[model samples]
Target: MQTITLDALIPREDFNILSSTGSSSNTRNKQTLSIEDLKYDSFFFSALRKPIFQRETNEWDAEKVCSMIESFVNDELVPAIILWRNQGGYIFVIDGAHRLSSLGAWINDDYGDGPISISFYGNYISDEQRKAAEKTRQLVNQKIGSFKEIEAISRNRISTENDLKNDIAKNLGALAIQLQWVDGNAAKAEDSFLKINQSATKISEAELELIKNREHSYAIAARAIVRAGKGYKYWSAYSITEQEHIVELSKKIHQLMFGIGNINMDDINSLPIGGPLNSSLTLDVVTQTVRICNGLDRKTKTNVGDANEVITYLRNTLRILQYINSKEKFSLGVHPFVYFYSGIGKHKIGSYYGFLMFAKELIEKKKIDNFIQVRSRFESVIYQYNFLVQQIIRKDRQSKRAYVSIKDYYVLLMEIILENPTYSNEAIVEEIKKNDKFKYLQTEIVDNETVAVKSNFSRGKKQQIKMETFVESLPRCPICGGYICSNSVSVDHIQRKQDGGTNAVENGQITHLYCNTTYKN
Candidate 1:
């Protein structure tokens, strides 16, 4: 074996006065590369192996990888791959994908267009299928080639790979190979790998996941949650952003439940089965439930085979919180309901759950110390739970509205909370006032001191304003901007119907017929 350039198999410097006395040996026609230095017996798999990215491979992808390698071996060019060394002893693939992929295929026994060697599968063939198999071999002999002839046919390979188990053992005995293999530091290797792959440009989910990592902030823990869930990929695949939301949510859940600054999957796996599946309030409930469980040092317990118990508690909690958020529908910002996701981080479940502790203390008041025990007892866990809570809430809210994208909403909420945690209602009102949607809010009461109009309410008959006049007077729909069909002059509940909304003037809103339909949906 020797390191050499592709231009010349035997580099002039390493060229030797070789003996080619055998009649069958070719002195001038043998394929040899210009080698800088040669060690004829040094060629081995370990010398060519490089650690890149420690990719976690499952059966499905493992199958695909084997197939990919088989395909590569059939072709001539070898594209580079990125490799990295993970905590695991295995070498991570960074680059030279085509080459190493072929290697994997060889190891997997997916060679010569057939899969072999690997175990875990049951019986290789059944008596019932033997006839079909025999027929296939007979056809290969007549149409393609005899198994022996096919085995000996000139292989279309630039790089040859084989093992003792393969039928091509005889061919391996006669082959001579000349090539160069280069390895570099893992980080630099990946950079080079990326440069090589940049040309081919296949965008992969793994890459997208890495992109979301943002230099591996708390995001790494979050990504880990999603990664674990990939084992259950039967669920819809979320976009990179939504995936991050799930991760962030996991982080929040860990934070709040145990006041844990980090997230742990062991805690998350305790949530109910349908918890992650639900896109609605189920996520929020699951998050809180997981937090509560983590708060109890549940992570240390090995008996948590199922999260059903904790999930049920979570549902109860959501049922309670829903009533509260419903009564005081506070819009943290645009898209009203989205406002609450940030609140999870604003205060722990204990803080909000204090309303209960209050009653327990003295029918209406829980002391600050009692609240602290509820909160600070699991301070680290609390952050984890809150992280999960906000994450689910984020995904739910984000899916409904792209108006305020995830990044924008997250940044804005964080900024506002950090800048002024105790922003007065008046201050919130002022900010609310700044929204373009609120500009149309009714001005004020008609003053009793007004010179002419003295009636407290419209009296006697309806003020006979003309249909055209009223039509011209009304504002356009703030939502859809169609003519607020003055014909249907009654106000509409701006919030919505299913939410137990009503058509009272205060609760109602002015909107054109067409716009109302759009808004209703």
Candidate 2:
């Protein structure tokens, strides 16, 4: 990802131009400034944030400024303020982040003494130096402090020392608290913040997802589900984005079906198991969970208990492992599983599994890139797997002893993964050739036998034995239970009249040709 240019990202310049005398020269003087102009200093704040400041931002204490700005940003009663320009585009505060975001609950009453009665707590300081700094702040705030230089910045933004309160509520629109430092400057600030602020930690995407939880109740519910569960973190999942994708998938499915504004906790029970969570193969577990939790006999009204959570989590985990460790030919390694499972609902289950496995093997064996191969192979396998699955489903529906040829297995043999993933004709024959049943059923071409046996790399074209006809029935004719179906079942040319069959019961009596000829002699 390339950095967005500052000029490109934030364009409209409607702020007072900086005069040479270190003051804002109000340029828009066509008419007297309205109360709207003074009501909130949007232009003034904008002027305070000119990009010129970002040029030499590193020379200043960015951490201290960012921290102070964070404070002003948090306080609600405080109006939009800026760290205004000096000469040129030297910038400062744009607006109160806290106040603009609506962080104040209420202003103090007039009868509550001259000072505003507000509830506020200072930083989570944990050192003597910080304590002394707090002491300095108190001294300045009480007008008896040594560090009076920051008195202007420290005047409680809201009034009772509270012009603004910085908690969770503030007029975010009026306060629109955006730090207008340059991208490069922001990077510098970030680097400095990391170096100087030893205790301050940056927000991670996981924590960010948690913080932004309220924005999307669907995500909130998914995060809550993961949080509520124990002994399982999404660390094993493909990626954080993939984990988020699962939540989004469920949210999308619900939105698509019911047009629900958000995912309902009760209705979420209907989600496809692992359908939302698994990063590879099928979301069988997700579907199953939704099925079990929402199915008629289930009881979602009683909050999904601990048992269900563990069962569901483990079920999905094991299913994913199964999807990974499937088929002797290939393994769907960690990386590709994440990539392929994103839009797998549109592909055939077996094909998805096979393609993932093939891609993983391809990455390791062929030394290919996982990202590109995943997408490219995914497209390739869709139609092939789709056809393979269609053939399987069709056979399954027909309820016949589905006969598949070994010649046909290569198409779907990327891997024989999943719970009974239907095999193609060639795959079935290969599987049967590997089978110990009817040892004579194989063609031992390489081994110099009539029938051959399968090799290690059956999926790849290596020298091999191929299975001929399906010899699923018993050795003897199942009906008569007397003669071997293998040889006794000779083609008794139906046109017996054409041959000089003596018109006698003995000649007419049907039997194995070998049995009949010897008996006549």
Candidate 3:
């Protein structure tokens, strides 16, 4: 659906405000507010806060946001915003968060890249997010005049030839949005929020779990890693020492998984997690990674533990990521391009989890050396017949289903290759078919039938061509003979430095971290 983010337009506040003093006896507040009330400096605007449990206000696209603004400006029958005044006198939006946030975004000109978002996210915004913000800004400015321009025109401080804009400016002050209030305690308001939001857009199970258990260790750790410990501090309630520990560990893991910039068609040399960073998906991945690393079942709902548990989860997750692709001594430096990406350059989430499971097994069983001995040949087989990965993922689109099969596939493939390192691609395929579980996987055969060709290539085809070229040109690690990229590169001394290896170029060789540090010695 290509949603645009307006999450930062409204700040999130905890709904646990019943304990605070100065409770508002009145159930309802104001009935309506004019466009002026939405201005950044307006008192009414300053009091508006979204509940912490509310989903991010990013479901609307640029067109939808702009349309809402246009409808408001045209005085259409927009729905009333439902709100609750907490005991602390803070006005919480029980419903219509996106609606109010969209209006505030227009008035403040902060679709997401504005000062509010930068400050809220602690200036860790990604290029993808910035680009989306710029696009929303451009679209809004083009379709409807900017709020500033319209305001200036209303005050006769500027002139424009467009008659429609002048009319909008003239009527802007008189536009007032209807407001509805929710009565009762914090629990009631929260209930109302869940009911309204669930009935409307329908929250995903993952998101609902996160919202319900926002303070859980897994949720805290996931949020920390997803935003690289820069966005809203979900763990702020922890002690300073614990918070610092959480940030340090989360940042390290974040760098390990997403240190490489956003993946694009032009650059196929290396990838961190095999795809662009998506907020929801990345959050889910981080949550899953934490659970799996901690030996927690995927379907189990864990309790909201203390900060120590959260830190432990983060540390365990970090260890797994380092083992996957890092410069650590014990790291296998598993190449993402080989294991996580599909034959046609698509990032396979199933393959990613499969590798995680495989890596965890190797670490647990102390079979890293065994795998390393057959790694080069194993990768060659996987690369030669990468279509199997595509078929497995396509067959089982769900990650849980695909991950187990892919992990088993890796284990079986490695067993066959270790049994006979000299096996050809066809020989390996024949051997793999012996396992009834993988019998459905077959090598692709070309039709060779003449068909009409398009003058232009599809984006996927272009990306595939680029990926092929990039893979063909990649440098192999001298020690492990596996592909190496910027993320996993380490320089080794042919003559051990302890044995008096000099700084001369002849003494140096490029190798994977594990190869140089552990395997070679």
Best prediction by lDDT: 3
Q: Candidate 1 vs candidate 2: which has greater lDDT? A: 1
Ranking, TM-score, top scorer first: 3, 1, 2
User: Which sections of candidate 1 miss by over 4 Å?
Assistant: 1-93, 97-106, 109-187, 202-215, 226-403, 406-521
What is the lDDT for 321 in model 2?
33
Q: TM-score of model 1 relative to the true fold?
A: 0.26
Q: Report the C-alpha lDDT of model 2 over 327-429, residue by residue, as the tens digit.
A: 2112222212122222222223333333333333443465322322222233333322334334443444343212122112322333332212454444544
For all predictions, the C-alpha RMSD in Å is: 22.6, 26.3, 2.9
Predicted structure with the largest TM-score when compared to the true one: 3
- lDDT per model vs. reference: 0.30, 0.28, 0.79
Model 1, 251: alpha-carbon shift in Å? 13
The local distance difference test score of model 1 is 0.30
For all candidates, what are the clash counts?
66, 58, 0
lDDT of 3 by residue, 262-306 (tens): 566456554666355644466567767777677776577689879
For model 2, the stretches where C-alpha displacement exceeds 4 angstroms are 1-43, 46-100, 103-190, 193-198, 205-261, 269-521
lDDT of 1 at 82: 39
Q: Kindly list the per-residue Cα lDDT of model 1 for residues 171-238, writing each as its tens digit.
A: 43343333422244434545554555556544343343333232232222222332222221211244
lDDT of 3: 0.79
